[model samples]
Every structure is written in C-alpha cells, then in structure tokens.
Target: MSRESGTATAEATPIHAQVSNLRPRDLLSKEDCLEMFRQVYLARYFDVRLIKEKKRGRLKGTLYSSHNQEAILVGALFGLKPTDWISPIHRDMPAFFLKDLRGDWNRPDRIGMSIEEVCAQVWGRVDSPGRARDNWSHIGSRSKKIIHSTSMLAGTIPVAAGLMYADRLNGGDAVCITFNGEGSTAQGIFHEAINYAAVHKLPVVTVVENNQWAYGTPFELGCATPDVADRAKGFGIPGLIADGQDVFDVYDKVMMAVEHARSGKGPSIVECKTFRAYGHGDHDDDRANKYRPQEEIIAGRARDPIGVCRQTLLDLGYISAAEATTYHAEGKNASEATNEDFPPEVVDYLNAGIEFALQSPLPAAEEGAMWVFKENN
Candidate 1:
C-alpha cells in the first residue's frame, strides 16, 4: 500500500531512463517492429472504445482496460512459443494480439461479437465466446494448457503453480506466466504463490504491472516495501525490476526469465513499473493527479509507449513518418468503426444479467431446509 516516492514524481530509474539511450538495433528489429506497434495501438484503441461505450451506456460492464500498459504484455509475449501458456488479468487483455493470431481487434463486428458472446453459447450472447465455462479471454484449451482469467484479485498465482506442476509431471519443458498488478501484492495469495514457486522450483514467472496506485491510494501508502520487486528476495527467487515503458527492456527481461526457467531454475519475479493512463473501472474516477503532480503526467506523455515505438520505427527508416501517420489514422478510424458496431441498451443489459443469474437457480436454496448431514432415503 506504499510507493517508492512521496507526492513528488519518482525519478526515472536507470532501467527506464535510458530507453532512448539504447543503440537503435538493440531496441527492435524491422521484422517485428511494425507488429509491436500494431499490438500496442490495437490495445489503446480497444480501451478507448470500451471507455466511450461505457459512458454511452452501450456496454454496462466495468472495464479494467490496458490503456497505457500495453508494452509489458505485448513485449513479453513477443517470443512465446505456441506451446507456452499465459494467464493474465482482465486489464491485460491486450495480449489478444498473441491469443487470437488470426483475429482482428480493430474490426467492430468481431470485437462486438467477442464481448457480448464471450460468456454465453446457448443464448449465443451477442458478444459472447460461444463456449461454456471458458469465455472472455479463455485462450487455453485443456490440451493447450491456457487457463481462463479470474476477476478475483491476485488469485491466479497458485493456479499457475498447479499448471507448472503438471508440466513437471509430464516432463514437459513448457512454462506458465501470471500477470498481476502492484495492488495485488498486498493479497495473501500473491505471497503464498511465490513462496511455493520458489520452494518447489516451479517454472512460473510473476509479472507485476506497477502503476503506482492501488485504485485510489498511491503505492507509497499501500505497501510496506518501496519496490514490489524487493519482495521476491523473501521467497528465494531472482527479482528482476525493469521499465515497463520500454518494450526492449520488457522483452529482454522476459527472455531472460524464459531462459532461466527453461534451464530448470526456480520461478522468478519480474516487476515492471509502468502507468495506468485510464481510470480503474469504466465509471471510476481517475483521481490520478491528486496522488501525483500534473507535470509528471504531462512529462510521461512525451514518450508514450506507442508513440515512442513508432518514432523509433521512423528514425530507423523502417517506415516513413507519413506512413506512420497514415497507420495511426487508420487505427483510429478502425477503433471508431468497432465502437459503433456493437451498441446495447443499459436497462436491457441489466435485466439480461439478472435473468441470466436467476435462471441458473441458487444451489443453496435446495439445501436450505435440510440438516447438516442427513442421508436417509
């Protein structure tokens, strides 16, 4: 519940400060450069659409969107093998770039279908996933080993551990990764998962997307430690702190973690300190300025992960500035198209949710009048 700095903006750490300082080739390659931009841009566009829809009452659910933290998820998955598994939180859905290799996040119809049908198949909920018990970002099938994300805060670590144990039993070389937030560090499950991972040498990498605030309180007031990465030492695992803002740093850190785990080393903790440019939930107040200086946000704006990445592409002559501008304009237009494609009414959605919940019937009601241990005919 605490942060690394006081009200004043925290000084840029060496890990993040030298993003522009790296040699051009060390940061990215022509082959994968544009792909990174596409993923980050798509994530931002998806978030903008979600926020606008929430405001318009077309989408009645809360959004823990990844407006600014796209680089961490995108970069980490850049080199993942098809056999690898990723378990992510709701906000980290930008990894859809990796999840749906053939799907287009910018298509309005597709995105709409995804959101409405993700949880329903019988009703074929318009935005639903068309599958049972595994909708909305359920990228992994039993054979694929990808686990569905739980909305519960800090709850996936042990689940990832169990998957790793499964891998060990089968003598598989695959790995499991879980992405959580800085706020989740306060949860007991976070510590328990890491402790077991370290003690048992599980092949799991815990990535912390640190945005400095736990909903309302700044990190300084939320936790006892300044750097959440420091907590890894207590579990006997290697702690790697990197700049979530720099796609290069994030990639390098992830690659190293992948290699370490593949080499039979224990699980490790990677804390990527980054920002959450949007609000906590769809209707939540940002209150970001109250916790930090306006100047920090403004300064932080200069090197937006998406902007910095595209600029790097231009500087390297991978794409002309005119092309970059066109690409961006195209992305924005696609976002608008997607946003308009799926519009719903608020009352209708509310009633639908209630009916869906009620139709299942309450299991407790059947046992309510029965004794604690009655088994007679």
Candidate 2:
C-alpha cells in the first residue's frame, strides 16, 4: 500500500495536491524518520510507565492511557515548528514533552516542556510549571508555548484561537494546535470557537483524536457524522482525516493542516481515527472493559501505533529484519511489557524524569490559598 493510501478520508480536498511532488513526510531525511519511530517508543513508554506507577500507588490522579493513540501525538507533533503552540488534553500527557522534541530532546532552549517538568506535574511536585497547584495534565508554560488545558472538553479551542489572533496582531506567524477527543466535538465551544477562528482566518488547527469511544459513550451516540472531520465543512475550513494508527499518515495530514493554517488560510480539523485502548481513566478501566465489547477492544488495539510505525520503517528499508525483532513493546499492556521491551535510551530518559520527580518537594500547604485571590499592591 502507498503511504497515502488507507483510512485517510477523501472528504476534504487535499491541500498538498497543489504542490504535486512533495508531501510533508517526503521532506524528511532517514534520520528524521528514525527519530519519529523513536518518539513513538518514548510516548508508549511514558504511558505504560505511568500506569505502572499509578497501579503501585506511587502516583496520584487518573491515568488516561494513550496506548493505541501514540501515533497521533508523535505524528501530529513532529511537523510543528518550535514556536508553534499546542494544547494537550488529559489523554495527551506525552505531548507535553513530545512537542519540539525532534532532534532537540535535551535542548534547554526548545519551546516545549522538559521531561522533568512533565514528570513533576505527574508527580504533583513543586518543580511543576504550575508549581503543583494544578493536578496532572494541567501544567503549562507560557515560555514553552503550551496552553494549559482544563477539565472542560473542547474549552481550549477559543483560547488557542484567541492566542493566535493576538500573535497575528503582534506580527507573529505562530500556529496553535489544540488536541481534543471526539466527544469534545459535541460541545458548543467546539463550534463557536471554530466559527470565530474561521471568520478571522486565525492560525488554529483543531486536532480531534477521535478514539471511537468517549468515556462511556461511543462515537455513534455523540456524533452525527461517521468522521469528525466532517464538522469542518460548516466552518468553511478543510476537514482532513488520517489513519490514527499510522504516524506517517498523521504527519502528512496534520502538516497539511498546519501549513494551511500557517499560510493564513484558517483553522482546519484533522480527525485522527483511533480507539481508546483503555477506559477514560484508570479508575474507569474495569467499567470500560465491561461496557465495551470484548471483540471491539481486541480489534481496537489490533493496530498498535508502535508496531505500525515500525512496519513502515521496515518497508522503507530503514531497519533490517533482525533489528525489527529486537524490541517487542507493542500489543502489551504496562504489566505485560518490561523495560527491556523498549530502547534503553527511552527507558533511561524516563528514569531521569522519574528520579527528578521523586526528589522534588511537594507544594507548600499555603499555596492553596496563595493563588486563590489577588491582594491590592
């Protein structure tokens, strides 16, 4: 199958078709492709490790596993410029560290949060950008260009649009990508924000991680269209779809949307079709298993994002057959997979973050009252 072939819907006209010869991924060197593959491993390792920690009572709050949805984070983030902003929701914890990670994982000047900071947020330590005042997935850095997300679904679209509008006024070309689940598309803010963005031609790319199931509700129950990308038409913007399991496909589609937004075309919706491998959160895991069909769960996780990306690399001759079989992390849950299943560097990188989080102090008790109200100077 060609790279462009597969679950990517044909509803939205292809933006890259005008270019004819060069798709975004086509511009990637062999090293860039390998880096994308490595990032997938990093994302998977982060989610599984966090699940293990929460299970062992070492972490707090809910664990929203991004098991099958790793491609969306890795692919969508890979093509972004360092200055571009992103708003990652509860299930997108890996995105905090994944943004601007392409060949600059350790660079202090990169416009993305550090692994240590993300780990601190997960651990609820004082070193968190929000100083542990907010819980997991609530931390954001203005310097890093990441928007802090709230519990309200699809709420950040307006914030992202407003941010980009201000950036344009200031003569900045920065684009903001807001990540949300398919369920959030049902919210009124989703329409209102996108409509506003369309009118202003703001550089906002709304990435709907349509993972089939939204909490206890299925996609069919909440959405009128089979593909969430269909919603983009109403706003007079492009709505492209990608095989959420394929990192390359996601990169191509999202990069198209990103380019469209950056060129002042306006906001676009790139719906990456995927499945929620686990429940809405760790606490709801058992209930999710019971509510969703056994066959559906099995089928949903069949195309592991790591495995898909690995196969693509193999097809491209980037890795030998022997190398492909070296580490088998895909298709295994946190309990089933071990550290050896991933690259040692990936494990070590996360270990450093965990160590930092462990040594960091908790927020002072008075912090709860400190940010609550403002005092007259």
lDDT of 1 at 241: 70
lDDT of 1 by residue, 273-308 (tens): 787665575455456555557776555444567766
lDDT of each: 0.61, 0.90
Candidate maximizing TM-score: 2
User: lDDT (0-100) at residue 14 of candidate 2?
Assistant: 42
lDDT for 121 in candidate 1 is 24
What does the lDDT come to for candidate 2?
Answer: 0.90
For model 1, the stretches where C-alpha displacement exceeds 4 angstroms are 1-29, 100-144, 286-293, 327-377
Per-candidate clashes, comma-separated: 20, 0
Best by lDDT: 2
Report the C-alpha displacement of residue 175, candidate 2, in angstroms. 0.5
Query: Candidate 1: what lDDT?
Result: 0.61
Q: What is the lDDT of residue 130 in candidate 1?
A: 20
Worst 10 residues of 2 by lDDT: 1-10
lDDT of 2 by residue, 1-377 (tens): 11233344433334666757577888899999999999999999999899888878898888888989999999999999999999999999999999899996898888898899999989989999999887879878889999988899999999999999999999999999999999999999999999999999999999999888889998989998768887887888888888899999999988988988888888899988889999899899999999999999998899999999999999999999999999989999999999999999899999999999999999989888896667879
